[model samples]
Target: MPGAGTSINALPKISLHDHLDGGLRPQTIIELAEPIGFALPTTDAAALGTWFADQADSGSLVEYLKTFDVTTGVMQTREGLVRVAREFVEDLAADGVIYGEIRWAPEQHLTRGLTLDQTVEAVQEGLEAGIALVAQAGSRIRVGQLITAMRHADRGLEIAELAVRHRGNGVVGFDIAGAELGFPAHNHRDAFDFLAKAFMPVTVHAGEADGLESIRGALFDGRALRLGHGVRLAEDIEIGREDEENTYVTLGPVAQWVRDREIALELSPSSNLQTGAIAAWGDDLLDHPFDLLYQLGFRVTVNTDNRLMSNTSLTKELALLSDAFGYDEDDLEVFQLNAVQASFLPLDEREDLADAIVAGFATV
Candidate 1:
């Protein structure tokens, strides 16, 4: 245990699962909306921030997702997208995120006149600007874009082409998000097939809004290297209590494959509780299967699925998990290490990040 004394913000961390549309600064939203004359729930920045949190805590995934309409509304133009992306990276740097991957669907931003390629270029510009600003402030941070396609939509193959086309730019991976219940990963088989041929890294939103079958599809059909909020993978794990302090867990074939292959599970604590992703386990943080999965040797990584919706940061999520499951500094270090290994960056870059984490923890 080290410098995580009530505040882990200073520790070097890697964020593998952050959403661009879900992590906007409240103040920025107000400024961007005024030019477009968009109607918001509130004009005051502080109240608007609280509004997002309160509205998202509705305990239903469908209700919680309704808050994104306001966010995506203002992000139609090049200016709006650029500003949001720039601020997103700056905020991550401030929060001590050494590396982050921001995932967002470009199809949603075509409501205006801009093309999908233009939207991607605009976001990349903002990310580069944000990186320069952070460097000027004497801190270093790197970020990548995970181009996403809504699973409910029929543009899977098109979006997959877009992602591969821009791979040389800022886009690092491809993902199929949106409603995961009825729209399974197999629905986007063409996209996954394209990504596989291109040798692109893929992370799918599975086991969050669905069950083991969804995760299975993500691995087999989607060829996902990671699972977004795969908290529901625990459904395949059966835990039994023996004596007072003795317990046992049995993993089904699906769970066993995920564990044996060391596929990363991006687990967001507060968001999971807010969206009822962990309802079957329990409604409280203590009832989450994150600890169980970690104990069973799963490559678990902590994340903030939606900072604005959950009103939380990476440090806050880790602290909350520590309080709930008694995780200490060493445990936190292991989580960071896992993220470094699972990153989409090159092997050398990942090794450097791991070294930085180890060095930072040493000082702590």
Candidate 2:
């Protein structure tokens, strides 16, 4: 097991739904805060990081989100945004992520004087800088931003236009995050409509905090290219033993459509458990519906929805999944392939990513 991560690291990986604000390094936060005169839960990076993970897993959703109050607090400036984004890529590179899509609601970053364009440009600068640094270190990583609109807020249309305006410049897609239960996808119809007309790719954070109706809304209304934490879609699936030799699986309409259409499920195991997203089934990693959905041929991709909050890297998430589900190199390779296929990049780029993944995996 000591070398398990080493092998997995040698394998190629793609991240589909990682959050930008949610992946900051605590030490970076502490350092960035000192100059800005910001207060923190704890000044020690180790303690503050654990505080975040513990608070997130504290079993109360209200308490969990309070952790973000700290992360987002420090990310309100151009320097903070750039530092976080720069470190975000470096971390992904260290974890062997070849390509990743980092999603965050830009509206959340406007608490300072930064315009939406400023924030996006700052993050892009950081990403490019990080990529350059990694390349200098003899590694490679490709990262794109998924501009998100907060679902509970009324800024979806504004965010959509912002996303469209930056399409070719690091912004690859649009998404909606936050409170999927009440803020149904239909509420963002105008935004989604505009995205559709612009032929922009979109992913929705549904089937995590809510159930099938939310998933339905995401598909019918948001036209999601991928499901952000769509693990709960397993609710529509019934798995029964068929004579101990085979298992019979029945998918209700929603799950069936998702599986048949190969809509990617951006399932983050640790984040899902921390947020109670998998509570309907059980409270353990083994109880996660990730394996079930993958076995049933849904486009199941692994992610770390909130790396800082969940105290995880995508490698750690995949390691945990392997421990829970006995996943091997082949299984891990399949997830990478799924992500490459579902990426917002053009077909040629996607194919190139697939080749890179294949070559990386072959190294082991």
Candidate 3:
């Protein structure tokens, strides 16, 4: 077992909620934008990185999402998409991710005249190339695309079909992200119905910017197998009595269903704080309901929702949690196992991932 000062970065990890557009290297963004004549807040990569993190820390999901404009602006072409996707994989591998599902909306990249299929193909090519590069470097990594749809847009059905079209190629799952308050998952019922008929695994962004009602819709209307930043489900938990000996709580219908059903909560510690997802609890990482949910047997997994925007990696997020909740190596291992079990891969593949994680942690 790992003792004090153990290196969390060396542990094998699985990333289920990372965003492609939101994980770009600042330097790469500068280079890509220059060629496209896209204006940025600054050309200096360090300052640009700081800008993203600072802008996203506004404690409002709507304000936090505006920073995506700069990222998606530079990703309107095939080359841009390929390069960004390639670097995203490399970064994840370096951060000790053995497997990851990179999610992005293809409809947002059509401004440069590329079709949605072409954009998906381009990203797949980049992901494959990144995997090959990692192998050449004597490291191992695997990835899949979680094709996403913008909740506020009318292309949910089209995006769902696009995801299904590429299901066997490189895509693994489907998600709906973007503003969650005004545009609930029920707005995309047609798309969810189609995906359900097609038997595609779905994860929806709910319970972050919105509350229990939105999460309820995501579960029943979208048939979501997992929740993206479903931190707000804690709203359903009522603290009854607390003392030095023990604390009692009650789970409402939504919370009980999610916990009993073992729906994975893709909790992003830093991003949740930045977007005020955990504001109801407190202002710091210690205030997060992750420990409560985990202690209650909820299938909670850690993630870096947007590495660049949050200025974090899976390793950093784990470290923060460890510090906040006094988590040891065993706790970290459980989190990884939860992520492996919740991954969108096939049963055999998820078993392989779980084995790999177990072996890796055994070494430490």
Candidate 4:
């Protein structure tokens, strides 16, 4: 039904795994950097955009990590945070994202003397502003923040507290990101325990740069309600060809539990290829295990991990998936429903979101 262009633009979307700093507009980066005396690889918007996407395309996690240094470098003050956050939501709203969860680590934004509380408040203000701007245009959209802690950093507890402190104030959930290989979710046990006691929802970045053991830590230790970039969970699956028209899949205990429990996997098509998470399968989107996981009944929700770095939007992501996997409106709707079910929003809110998505898709 979504035939591309305005059709896809009209379909409502729910983004569960998007990074805040990673979605900054290039012009915003240059404008914000000028006041802070921060220099970038390029000042021209087109060239700068290419630079971010190229760095991410290096297929090296270390190189990808370097790209963020420029983004985080600019988001150190109240003004920069608010401006970036405002534009981020506005862009998502314009792209037909009815509901979104923007994730970023406040600890990383403390370089230029902003208290964690101030940074959160500033971002909240920006999100609210963006919401108002959309409303003024006769369009309705909502966004919630997922307060993230860098796995390699030592500020998990503090960030978790920050998320809880702003629970009903635009903040939706908590997450642990960055350096997923060596720094297991167990490293943030104290923070996870604190969030568990506080009864907050969490999502952990696992199965992206690591395997099943990392996913186990995300579940048992971090208590992640959703698995961030859990593409590698496919490693636990064994496939064998049956007759001419059939095939069979056998899931290991962990993968079986995940599928049985309906754990949502935030599968970012472009970003996964860029970061080499799906290298075992292949490098192209066509080679991704997304279709396999979908056919296996896994809770597979699509996302643009980093909008700027990937130079993508939810519409483009869906179009690319459709092109790569020959999917239709039904498949896209499944992704939206999975994301809605996996969102940290309350029961009534999530139901409302799902209903809206269904109705919006009906138009196409």
Candidate 5:
């Protein structure tokens, strides 16, 4: 059995919810911005990294989102997107991520002059370069793009089409992100409808800044195969202590359906805490309902929503969860397997990924 004595970084992992723009290296940001005449809060890479973390530490999701303006500011060109995407995959490989799905909105990266297709192609080239670099080092890592649309925008159908157009390329799935409160998934019904007809896989940013109603829209309206930081689904759970040793957790329809249907929850521990996504429960990691959901047999998979903003990696996220819940290596492996099962990859590829994960963990 895998145990806590093994190093978490050495374990093979799958990242289901990492954001591409949000994972840019500070030094890379500085280099990329230099050619574009972009103004940053600071040019010093280390200081700039700290600034991102500090800005995102605010307890409001809206306030936390303001930091993305800076990251996306530098990624408005083909070169910038390529460099950022390449380094993003290298970072994932270094962190022991065997498979990862990088999510970003192409609409957000078109400010400088790049068309949506150009942005996707640029990022795909970078991802391929990064994968090749890893392979050259005698290591293997696979990554796919989850083309995202900003929920507050009306470009969902266009973005969904872009994702489908590149389905045979590096693109694997679609996602809707950005402010989840007022803009329900129904706002992008046409896009979701198109994706449903095209048979494209989807994941939605629900139950993060909103409650059950928003999640319901993501399911019934957006048809999300997975939930992006769906921590607030816990709001639907009612807990009562029967005694010192016994407790009762009553699940609402939303929570019950999510659990019963085996829909994956792309939980980001640090990002969730920083954005107040788990505020209904408490302020610290201990207060997070991740352990509760996991114990209850929900398809809970761990992730780093924004590595730069949260200053975390897949390894660190796993370590933090382990520390908070006293989870052992076996528990971590279970989480990795959950991600593999939920990935948009085809059946044989997912089976291969699962086999690789089990083999990697066996050595630990």
Candidate 6:
């Protein structure tokens, strides 16, 4: 058994749902915003960080998403994208993330006249630079871009092509994000179909602001290999009765399929509570269905969806889960293994990551 004295921050982890734009350092935002004459609510880095957290804790998904305007506003230039992407990797490494997939929409970064390809190349350059810096410092970390398309926009097919175009580069997967309620995954069917034909892996933002129907559309229409913030899938589970020896519940078809197929749920506990994704259950972290889903054998993986917005790191999120559910080192290892298995990497690469994780955990 793993020792209880181990530090959660020291555990090697994998991040599947972290956002490139959402992980910016407040100081980086300040510097990036200056040359462009983009005015901010506050110029001080610490104050700006607090501003993001305050603005994002709106308890409404739409409102919470508004905080991204400030971030994407600064990322419209190649310099901005590179710097942000570099810092994103460095921060993940500092948090002990062995592997991370950074997701961001190329469509959103085109407002400053940079073409989609240029933006991807720029970000890739930054990611490589960050990786080199980590190696120079005698530490190691790996990252990939999950090229994303805005669900509310009509550029899905274009973005999907762009992702496939850069697959040999740093891009690893495709995703659709933004406004999940009205904009179902099927809205991007052409793009999804293109990706499916190209054999590109996908993960969709479903069961966050939406429900089972949205999750079903993601699985059917988007062909998502994983679900982003799929916490709402818990709604499909109905508890009948509980005794000292057992607690029995029934699973709806959607939940049953997800569980049986082991489709990974990228559960960001802090982000879920801030966006009210788990409001139907309760307002607190303890109220989150993460424990419920994990106990029921769902392939649940921990993530820090937006580290800046949630004012959290992967370590902090895992610590919060431990505090809420009494999970020890062994349980935390399960989440890391789950994330590694669900990652977009090839089977051999996934096995390599799993081995690294297991070796790291064994020491602790």
Best prediction by lDDT? 3
The TM-score between candidate 5 and the true structure equals 0.98
Alpha carbon deviation, residue 41, candidate 1 (Å): 0.7
Which segments of candidate 1 are over 4 A away from where they belong? 1-6, 243-245
lDDT of 1 by residue, 1-364 (tens): 3343535888899999999999999998999899899999999999999999999997777888899999999999999999999999999998889999999999999988999999999999999999999999999999999999999999999999999999999999998888888999988999999999999999999998889989999999999999999999999998899999998888999999999999999999999999999999789999999999999899999999999999999988988998888888889999999999988989999999999999987775
Error of 4 at 308 (Å): 0.8
Query: Which regions of candidate 4 deviate over 4 angstroms?
Result: 1-6, 242-246
Per-model lDDT = 0.93, 0.89, 0.95, 0.92, 0.94, 0.94
Off by over 4 Å in 6: 1-4, 242-246
Q: What's the number of clashes in each of the models?
A: 0, 0, 0, 0, 0, 0
Q: Give the CA lDDT, 0 to 100, for residue 36 in model 3.
A: 88
lDDT of 2 by residue, 121-234 (tens): 999999999999999999999999999998999989999999999997899999998777788999999999999999999999998888999999999999998999887898
> Which residue pairs in model 2 clash with each other?
none
Q: Write the per-residue lDDT of candidate 6 for residues 1-364, one digit (tens) a residue.
A: 2356787778899999999989999999999999999999999999999999999999999999999999999999999999999889999999999999999998889898999999999999999999999899888999999999999999999999999999999899999999999999889999999999999999999999999999999999998889999999999999975877876899999999999999999999999999999999999999999999999999999999999999999999999998888888889999999999999999999999999999999986
On residues 127-219, what C-alpha lDDT tens digit does candidate 3 reach at each position?
999999999988999999999999999999999999999998899999999999999999999999999999999999999999999999999
Output the better candidate (3/4) by lDDT.
Answer: 3
Score residue 298 of candidate 6 by CA lDDT: 98
lDDT tens readout by residue for model 5, 119-140: 9999999999999999998889
- Cα-based lDDT at residue 32, candidate 6: 92
Off by over 4 Å in 2: 1-6, 60-62, 241-247
Residue 3 displacement (Å), model 1: 6.0
Error of model 4, residue 76, in angstroms: 0.6
